[model samples]
Target: MTTQDWWRGAVIYQVYPRSYADTNGDGVGDLPGIIAKLDHIASLGVDAIWISPFFKSPMDDFGYDISDYRDVDPLFGSLADFDILLARAHELGLKVMIDQVLSHTSAQHDWFLQSRESRTNDKSDWYVWADANQDGTPPNNWLSIFGGGAWQWEPRRQQYYLHNFLASQPDLNFHNPDVQQAVLDNVEFWLAKGVDGLRLDAINFCFHDAQLRDNPAKPVEARQGRGFSEDNPYAFQYHYYNNTQPENLPFLERLRALMDRYPGTAALGEISSEDSLATMAEYTQEGRLHMGYSFELLTNDYSAGYIRSTVETLEARVSEGWPCWSVSNHDVVRVATRWAQGEPSDAQCKMLTAMVCSLRGSVCLYQGEELGLPEAEIPFEQLQDPYGIAFWPNFKGRDGCRTPMPWQSEGEHAGFSDASPWLPIPESHRARAVSQQDRAADSVLNSFRQFMNWRKTQPTLMGGSIQFLDAPEPVLLFVREQGDERLLCGFNLGDKPVSLNIEQLGSAHTVLSDHGLREAQREGNVLAFPPYGIFFARLA
Candidate 1:
C-alpha cells in the first residue's frame, strides 16, 4: 500500500490497555507495560496497534468517560510514558492509533463543569442540555444505552443533560460550532503527537435531533441485539432521534479536513444507529472518515447468508469509502465463544481470525484473540462493567471479554499482573495463554501469525473487490478480484465435514495452499473440508 493509504486493508491489532500488561504491578495495565511488549505485538505481523482510551478519567465507564483529552490517566501512566511507547512501536515498524471519544465528555470535564455551572456561564451550550416537560420530566423519551432514561437532571441549571451512556458521560452539543472546534482541537493534539490514526468511538452520536423529538418505539418482537437484549429497555426504541443525526456529517467533514492536515493519518469511526450499515456508508465517503465499522458481525448471527448479506449490503452502498470488520472487541463476547457452532476448536478460532482479516477492508484483531481466548464468566460479585450489573442474568455485561490478557500459563494472574486483576482471568483462559502457544506450530496463535505474514504478500487480498458466491450451508464461498488476480476463498462454518464440487473454476487454478491453513483438501474439481476448514486458491 502507498504511504498515504497504509491503513487500507491493514490488520490493526487492538490493545485494550487495561488488560494488556502491567509493569507497575498495580493490577492495571499501563503505557509502560505496552512498551515492555512491543516485540510480542510486532511478532504477530499486524500493521498497527489501536490502543483503547488511557486518558485521565474517574474510571466511571473506564477510560471512555474522559475527564481530560490532552493528558494520560495517572492510573495508566504519564504522558511521557505514552510518548515512549509510541516511539517504541514506531521503531518496531508498527503504526499507533489512539481512541478518540468525540461525542461526549466526562461530567467532571472542565467543559462540562463550566457548561453546567449555570445557564449564564460562558460555556453553557457546550453540552446537550434542554428544558424538561411541563410535568418536570425529561425533555424527551431517549433511553441511555447503559440503562434508564438518557437525560440526567442537573439541578445547577434546572435542566436535563443528555447521556447516551453512563450519567458521567455527558453528550456534547455538536450544534454549537464552538463544541465542534474544541473536539477537533483535542483530536489534533493527538494527531500532532505523531500518532498514525484514530479509532473514533461513538462517532455517530456526535449530534442529536435539534428538535428534541421523541423516538418511536420498536415493535415488541424486534427488541433485541445491537448491543442490548430485550431485557434492557435500551432495545425498546428505534433510537432515531438521539443519535446519527445528519448534522454529524458536516462535523465529520471538519474532522476529516483536520486529519488531512496531518497526511497519512486516518480515522475509523464506530457507527451504531437505527440503520448502522447505511450510516456507515454515509460517514465514510470522500471528505469524511477514512473507514467505518458497525456491530453487524459482532452479533450471534453466524450463518454464511447473514455474513454475505451484511458485507454485500455495505459493498453496494460504499463507493469511495472503506469498511473495517471485527468479530470481537472489548465490548462483547470473544469470537471463539460467540460464533462457536459446537465445541469451540482451535481451528475455528484461527479460521475466524483469517475470515475477518480476509474481508475486503481492514481488520481489528482484539487482544488475546491470537491466543484463542474465550469469554470469561464473571460472577455478579466480581462484575466491574456497570452494563452487565444492570442487566444481570439477561446480559452478563462486557467483563467477560474485558478480562486480563493471559500471558503465561503458570502464574498468579496469568502473568498479567502481580495484584488481583480488575476482572478475573478464567482458569480455562490460562490454558490458552501466550506462553502455551507461542512456539506450538499448530496452535491458534502460531496459525494467526503465519496467516497474517502470508496475507501481506497477497496484493489481491489487500485491495480487492469481494463477490459472495452461492454456496451451500456450512460453507461460504467468495471471490476477491483485483485486476487480473482472482483469489477464491471458502470456509466450512460448521463442525461436520463437507465435500462439494465448485464448477465455477473450470481450470482449477493454482491452490494458494502456502498460507499455513494446510488442511483444505482439493481433489480435481471437488473441495473437501473438515470442521472449521479454510481454503484459498488463485484463479487461472
Candidate 2:
C-alpha cells in the first residue's frame, strides 16, 4: 500500500508502554525499551504500532492524564528517546501511532491549573466550569465513569468542573476556539516530529452540551458498560448531554484539516457513547476521523450471531469511513479468558486472531494477545489501577489485562524488568512467553505470526466486502470478496465439534489450515470442525 492509504486494512499492534519492556531497570517500560523490541514487533507482520500514552503525567490515570503534551514522561524517557523510537520503527517499516488524549487532561496540567485559579484568568474558560446550584449541589446530575458525581468543586473559582473520568482528568472546554486551536497545535507538534498517526482517546468526549443540561436517567435494561459496570452508577444515566455532542463533528473536521497538512498520517479514534456505532460512523465520515473503533467487540458477548450483527450494523452505518476492530485491548479482560467458556486454549487464540483480522477495514491487535495470554489475577494489595482499587471483586478494573508482557520463560519478572514489574506477572503467563513460543511451531504466538503474514498476501482478505453466510449457532461463515478473488472463512466459535457440507458452502478449496482439532474427518462434501477450529478457503 502507498503512504496515502497505508492505514487502510492495516494491522496495527497496540503496545501498552508500561508493560511492554523496561531498559532502565526501573520496573517500568519506556521508549528506549520499545526501541529495543522493534524487531520483535516487525516480526509480527503488522503495518504499524499504536503505543499507549507515554506523556508526562502524575500517573493518576496512568499516562492518560497528561501534564505535558509535547514532552515524554521521565518514566518513559526524554523526547530524544521518542525520536529514536520513531526512527527505529520507521526503519523497520512500522508506522508509529502515539496516543492523543484530547478530551481531558490532568488537573495538574498548566491549562487546568490556570483555568481553575480564578474565573478572571485567561485560561479560566479552557475547562468545563459551571456554577453550583442554590442548594450547593453540582450544576447537573452527570456522573463520572470512575464513579461518584462528575462535578468537582473548586474553591478558587467557586464553581464546579466536569470530569468524565477521574477527577484529576478534568474535561476540556472544546467549545472554546482557543482550546481547540491549542489541541491542534499540540497534535501539529507531533506531526512535525515525523510521527505517522495518532490514536485519539475518548474522541467523543471532545465536545459536551453547552447548556450543561442534566443527563436523563437510563433505564436498567438500556445500560451498557463503557468502562465500569452497572453497579458503578456511571451506567445509570443516558449520558446524552455530557458527551457525544453534535458540535464534535465540526471540531473533528478541524482536527482532520490539521492531519491533512501532514501527508500520509492517519487518525484512529476511540469512541464510547450510548450509540457508539452511530458515533463511529459519524466521526469517520469523509474529512473527519480516518478510522474508528469501539468497545462493542471487546465486551464479553461471544456468540457468532452477536458478532455478525455488530459488524453488519457498522458496515451499514459507515459508508465512506473505515472501521477498525479489536477483540482485546488494555482496558478489558483478555479475549482468551473473556471468550473462553472454560480454560483458555491455543486453538481459541489463533481462531480469534484470524476472525478479527479477516474483517473489513483495519485491525488493532493488543499486546500479549499473540500468546493467548489470559487475564492475570492481581491480588487486591498488588493492584495498581485506581479503577480497580475503587471497585474490587465484581469489577477488578483493567490491571488484569495491563500485566507486563512476558519475554522470557524463566527469569525475574519474566524478563520484562530486572526489578519487580509494575504489576505482578502470573506464573501461567511464563509458559506462553515469547521465548517459549518462539521455539514451538504450533504455539499460539507462531500461529499469529503465520496468519498475519499470510493475510498480507490475500488481497481479498485485506480489503474485501464481507457477507455473512447462514450457519448454525456455533459456526460462523463469511465470504470476503475483492476483485476476482473470493475467500470463505469459517470458525467454530464454540467448544463442541461442528459439521457442515462444503458443497453447501459453494465450490471451494481449502487454502489454509492451523492447529485446530478435527474429531471427524471430512467425508465427501461434508466438513467437520473440532473445538475452536478455523478454516480458510478460496471459492472457485
**What TM-score fits each model?**
0.98, 0.98
Poorly placed runs, candidate 1 (over 4 Å): 514-518
**Candidate 1 C-alpha lDDT tens digits along 1-540:** 688999999999999999899989899999998999999999999999999999999998999999999999999999999999999999999999999999999999999999999998889999999998999999999999998999999999999999999999999999999998988889999999999999999999999999999999999898757766558888889989999988988899988999999999999999988889999999999999999988999999998889999999999999999999999999988888998877667878987887888889999989989988887889899999889898998888999999998999997899999999888899999889899998677888888888888898988888999999988998888999999988998888888898999987667565555444635687888989888888888888
Q: Write the per-residue lDDT of candidate 2 for residues 1-540, one digit (tens) a residue.
A: 566989999999999999999999999999898999999999989999999999999999999999999999999999999999999999999999999999999999999989988999999899999999999999999998988999999999999999999999999999999999999999999999998999999999988899989899888887778656658898889889999999999999999999999999999999999988999999999999999989989887899999999999999999999999999999999999999979997888888888899888899999999889999999999999888899887899899999999999998789899998889999999999999999998888888888888888888887789999888888888899988888988888988889987664456677775533222345667778888877887887
What clash pairs does model 2 have? Answer: none
Off by over 4 Å in 2: 502-504, 514-524
| RMSD in Å for all candidates | 1.1, 1.4
Clash totals, every prediction: 0, 0
lDDT of 2: 0.90
